[model samples]
Target: MASAPQAQGLPLFYNDLQPLSSDLHANYKIRRAETAPFLAKQHAVPLTVEEFPLVQRYLPIVFSMGDEPVPLGLMGLNEGINVFFDADGKFRENEPFYIPAYIRRYPYMLARLRPDAEELSLCFDPTSDSIGDFEEGEALFEDGKPSELVQQVLKFNEDFEIAGQKTNAFMKELKELGLLMDGEVSIQPDGAAQPYIYRGFQMIDENKLNEMRGDQLRKIVQNGMLPLIYAHLFSLNLMREIFGRQMQQGAVAQQEQPAA
Candidate 1:
């Protein structure tokens, strides 16, 4: 669900990558996306700690299941199911949903040019129609130099990279403290005979959180990490909301099936 082939694993929504340069893409223009076809089938997206408060209000924030767990914003409880968006990647309802910066930064990201490269380079997905030679759109370069728009885009990606670093640090702390645990959520519709159980994800263990030493709790609070943790915990209720939406969209039927 992430990206196309690359020597280093590419992030989400990119089919191909090429370093942005005045020499190679001098005539290129960055166009605004009318619809995100790449996001149509993506149910979950990588999330940074910075977005926790805002993202919590709409999507259930959970951690991906693995030895190295990363935060994810759930668009749907199950794979290949995105209730918030339609087949064209447009919002299904008039109610606003917080679009994660990870999604907004699609087609462009900072990546190492080589495995041993010390510095990251501004690279873009060449397959994206958003960045290409076009008669109408914001110019990527002016007078053989990067335009103001390109600089702004670069700044956004740089900020995202910083946020990613913070997220990694946060995850490391959680792991060290032994806070995250395999998560499971079960929902039983009013008339359903069996409850649909969702699993294969990670979440903060509330039992462990409640039993933490005062000093450990204070450390996270002092660093403003407490609220972010709560945001993720509070957002878990939205799983049922998303499930309801799936039913309304006909993605889920009356029949019981395992959800993972």
Candidate 2:
């Protein structure tokens, strides 16, 4: 893990997002064990799978552990921890796709890790209309090949290194957490990649319906239980504004009724 950057002039929200517990190491180990196999099978390779509950999974952990108001520098790190799917299984970088900037940062990290002349100068053209714009290109099912994008991700992980002390510290933490998995999990560049599909969670229209249903259900049981549970505390603040306006209108109506 990199040293947390300086906190000068940063918002209080950034500091409020520290790790909920030191149990992240164990969580990550279990997640990796489970996801690796699923991804491998999806890609038609031999791999392991670990059963992970969606709510108790990666994004939640990252959100709980992330420093907030998140530094722009670290915003992408969380996105990288999760997997993505494309309906068409093909992506070009310049297009306004949903992939976050932080997710795109992996190629940069890979270039730093490998440092080969051809690889280093690969110029990840974030602005290009070419298919190369996205590191993971479309999965080629006919040839059983992963998209270029997946290749880039693997290349980066292959080359990442930490400072000696930091590496030791992370290792110690891993050992203490009992996650001393020895072998490196590699997704070969030429391996068949999994078909990309749209994640239902990312589907906005359906999600809106689900959210509304949850809101209504919670309101019935506890007035606004769902809002509080979902961390939409601002909704209460908005209600206060509406209440104030209603009160002002009532005051005007009372005055007019007396005058008439």
Candidate 3:
């Protein structure tokens, strides 16, 4: 298994409006892998005693086209993980983080370019109990109408490669802009042949980050963080704009504020 720090080095990180030294990139990757899982477990389903080891052993690879292994941290493989916010934090999970469009298309891509591999599976954590259903919030990338949010994220990832960026700086920008949000993943255990839910960090709002100030935000923008941050920001902004507009129009007058 790759050590946490070793794994992070594979992904590039931007800093000071320029990509950071290779050494710094390595540090961020390790940090992400070590920290992300703890966050995922917060929103994941509770693991039964028997399932603990499987959950612990499996680590999640946060998806980003720019960074080969975008380590958004780690998550348990089984149910009972979740996302949380410190009392002083600025964001909250208003809704479950839906799977991205690119991920949905991966199964087909794998089938078309079948490779000799030991094993392959899609690991995710679903926020809602209705794990079997993907009717709503399903992202389909076809006919040039890929999920708008995902498209933006992919672009941001590409920029990271073009410009060279660092990881910690990118995350700092994400937090400052409020683009990062709680996310969920559903994983299929090695032998069970069944899918299970686990929770983790995800990109929610995009535009809110536009309000952020200072060179820190600029550094993140210059780095590859643009794609992930923008995707999350757009998603959250879209939801809020739609819902907020609906409420103003009296579409759902009795709705209550989301729980923190």
lDDT by residue (1-260, candidate 3, tens digit) is 11122233221111112121223222211101112222332212211112222322232333221222233322222223222322222123465443322222211111111246543222122221212234444342334344454455445444433322344444444455555444543433345344443333353443456665677577666765555544333333233332333334343223234577
- Against the hidden reference, what TM-scores do the models get? 0.94, 0.19, 0.23
Candidate 2's residue-wise lDDT over 1-260, tens digit each? Answer: 11122445321112212111123211211101111211111111100011012211212111111221111111111122112222232321343423222333322322322335454322232222322213343431223444454465445434332222333343243233332221111111223242212111110122432545554555434632232223222211222232233243331112112342
Worst 10 residues of 1 by lDDT: 1-10
Ranking by lDDT: 1, 3, 2
Give the TM-score (vs. native) of candidate 2. Answer: 0.19
TM-score between candidate 3 and the true structure: 0.23
The collision pairs in model 1 are none
How many residue pairs clash in all the candidates, one count each?
Answer: 0, 12, 36
Poorly placed runs, candidate 2 (over 4 Å): 1-84, 87-102, 110-168, 176-260
The lowest-lDDT stretch of 10 consecutive residues in candidate 2 is: 43-52
TM-score of candidate 1 relative to the true fold: 0.94
Q: lDDT by residue for model 1 over 76-95, one digit each (tens)?
A: 87777888887997777787
**Residue 104 lDDT (model 2):** 33
Model 1 ranges with Cα > 4 A deviation: 1-8, 253-260
